[model samples]
Structure formats: C-alpha cells, structure tokens
Target: MEISKNIRESKKNILLLANKKNKGHIPSAFSIINFVYLFYENKLNINNDFILSKGHGCLALYSVLEHFNYITTEVFFSFGDFDSILGGHPHLRKNNEIKASTGSLGHGLPIAVGKALAAKINQSSKKIFCLIGDGEANEGTTWESAILADNLKLNNLICIVDNNQSQNRSIPTPNLQKKFSSFGWDVITIDGHNSNEILSVFNLNTINPLCVIMNTKKGKGIADMESNFQEWHHKGITDNLLKLYIKEIHEEAIS
Candidate 1:
C-alpha cells in the first residue's frame, strides 16, 4: 500500500514530539497506526467509542486525532509537558475524545466491556472498540474480560489485539486467533499495516464479541527501528538520529 504523505509526516511529528519531551513508546505506538487511522477515517466516532487499551500507544492515537482535527496541532506537540492535556497515557479528565484513562495494562478492555454492556442495555446503537497489546494477553484480567464479553454476547464490542510480538522475550501468544476462538468470540487475523484489511474488519460478522488479531511489526515505518525494535521501544532519539530515521521513512513512503 502507498503510504499517505500526511501519515508519513505524522510519523516525523511523532518522533519530534518524543524527541522534544523524551517520552513515548515509539515501536508500540507505530504498530497500531493503521488501525486507528482507519477507525477515525471511517468516522466510527459518530456512534461508537474507542479505547486504547494499550495506552502506551497514545502517540499513534494522538497522531491520528490531530490529523482528523479531533485535536489541534498545538496540543499535539505539547505531549508529555507537565500542563499538556495529552500525556504518556490517555486520560479522561484531560480529553473528552479519550474514552478511558488507561496506562496500567489489562484495564482498558474491561472498561470497554462495561461501556458495551451499558450501550446494549440502553439499546443505544453505539459500538465499543478497544485496542490491546499482545503482551497484555499475559494479564489474567484480559482473558477474564474476554470471557465476560463473550458470555454477555456483546456483539457491539470489538477488541483488537495489536499482535506485534514484542512480548516474545517474556510471554508469547503464538495462536491468538485460536485462543480467542476458544473463548467463544469471533476472531480474525490480518496484516496490521494493510489499510484495506483494517477497514474491512468493521463489516465482518460478529457472533459473540469480535476479536481482531492484527499482526504488525513493531516500529513499522523505518527499517532500522523495525530491525532493532527493542531498543526503539521507548527510546529518545538525538537530532541526527531522528533526521536519519525520518529520511528512511520518507524513502519508504516514496519508494
């Protein structure tokens, strides 16, 4: 897929903002950009809610939100400042667009489940979508939430696992599709970088709760970052390094 110049440039801003504030889990944030890109592009915000269960990926959401005008550019660059509305994690008190305050792993999906349940009970047409990390699957609460969501038949809920394999060094979910299926949820696996695949998911049938396992590469845009993802996971880059990284990403965009 051809990368849009706006998204390409947003990559630079993400790096620059992190470089400025010295905060952000770049690789974790990069892995899920396309998912959030499609989510906002499709304007699911009209009657749906989204939760970044893996709150460390806030940079990705920030990038998308700014591009969509959900947030201003001024606030975009203010990330991690003591007075900024946006922070390292999503905060409800800071921003209305942020559906839930999330940072501690394993909490977002449970919160999403509650929202979906409320929507269902209220007979509201709103759908709840939550994005989580593969490493978060290690948390028992994540699985417990999955059990509860499926049991409740929250067909209005969708949970996406950013299956970037960053947790292989600790715990690995080799067959996330099978695991979700076993939990009685409809599951689909796809390349996370593919925009078409990401957008197509919203139309798929949902039996219980739908679980999308997006197979993504950590630090997806730049070659070196993807190659040495662990080092770039939560790294702060020097100006020279940032320039090189931006050049590499620009090269990929134009290639």
Candidate 2:
C-alpha cells in the first residue's frame, strides 16, 4: 500500500511538472513509477548497476531520485529545460546516481546483459536491472539480447517490460508474455497498477533471465488520463489542469 501511495503521489507530481513544462510521455512516466520506486526502495543493487531502457519514462526515475535527495529541487523544477541536470531522459554523466544514459531504447538491455555476464564470470554478487517498454520491445536488438540472456543463463540479470498497451500512437496487440516465453525467458505477467502484484513479480528468482510483463494503462491514476491515450500522452501541461489534477491525486493518495 505504501508503494502504491508513493507511486500515485510521485506520478501526480511528475505529471504536474510535465504539464508545466509541456512535456511528452507523462503517462509512461506514471506507469513505471512503482517499479522504479520498488527498485530503489527494495530491489536494485543501487551501488552497482541499473538501467531505464524506457527512457521516455525518465520522469519516474527522476522523481524517485529527487525524492531521495540525489538531486536538488531546483534541478527537478528545471527539467527538460536548458542546463538542468534532469533531462527528459536518464543521463549518467549528469549525475553519478544514474547508472546509465538511457534514451536510446533497446540498447540498455544488451548492455545490462553484458554486465551481468561479466559479473557472473568474475564471481561477483553484483547484479543488473533494466526497465524497458513493451513498445520498445519491437526493436530486433531487444530480442537478440533476450536470447543471449537466456542462453547464457544470466540469472543475475533482470528486465522488466512496461506493457502499457500503447506505444508511439499505437497500442501493442501482440502477446508480450508469449513472446518472452518463446525466447526462453522466465516470464511473469501482472497488473502494473497493483503494488502487491508488482512486488510479487520482484520476488521471482530463476536460473535464467526474467522478464516481467506489467499490464498498465498509459495514463494511470489521473481520472481524465488513465487509458485515455488521446489527451495526455504528450501535451503541454496547463496550469489549470495541473492544479486540478494534483488536488485530485492527493485526495486519492490519502484515501
């Protein structure tokens, strides 16, 4: 419940900021917050490695970082603007806390796979986590990386797909879990909006690489936005709408 509350609150504020900044990918940002929060709070090997392959959802990562004091409030407010450390995507050079610069889609997974392989060879306990989008899974390289992860049995490596149906103007129509299963991955599917369900996916430990397919709405938690794919995906955040939405989110967060 705390994780859900954090996801809801962080997502609301991130959307408010996105609206003020006229940003895109606001819903994707909301959809991944809980996983991001959980990775930071409980799952990830923070001192080691992690990747946000779905870099459009960087707002979720940034919100968690800002919440935890990895960056300043001024930097967060200035996101997407010039000279701000927080860009629309994660950049490791800008902040040491960011494990990788991940706007390139489909690239982070292979890289994480390499790291996991290296760690396994070196007999290191460190691990790698990569969060990607279902839409981004359309990339051929992502599947190639999945095959490698499975063949090598990189159990220390974990990847999550934000299966939010819609991607770049079209919703994903294919069976995501089936695709991963065919790749020989240990696949699990769950409701992304439910914190408990998300947490359960995190509990999976396997001899092969794991791929979690999270079924999420593009714009979850916002009354006018959840699955409304048309209005809020990449629009300018109006001040009026921002205020109303924030108020609504806060009320829902506490309830």
Candidate 2 residues 18-95, lDDT tens each? Answer: 777888678788777777777777735455576888887888888887777777777887888888888878788998
Regions of candidate 2 where Cα sits further than 4 Å from its true position: 1-4, 168-173, 253-255
* lDDT, candidates in the order shown: 0.87, 0.78
Q: How big is the positional error of residue 235 in model 2, measured in Å on the Cα after superposition? A: 1.9
Worst 10 residues of 1 by lDDT: 1-10
Residue pairs with backbone atoms closer than 3 Å in model 2 (clashes): 19-237
Question: What is the Å distance of residue 239 in model 2 from its true position?
Answer: 1.4
Q: Pick the candidate with the highest TM-score.
A: 1
Model 1: how far is 176 from its true place, Å? 0.8
What tens-digit string does per-residue lDDT give for candidate 1 at 160-212?
99999998788887788898999999988888888778878977767689999
| Local distance difference test, candidate 1 | 0.87
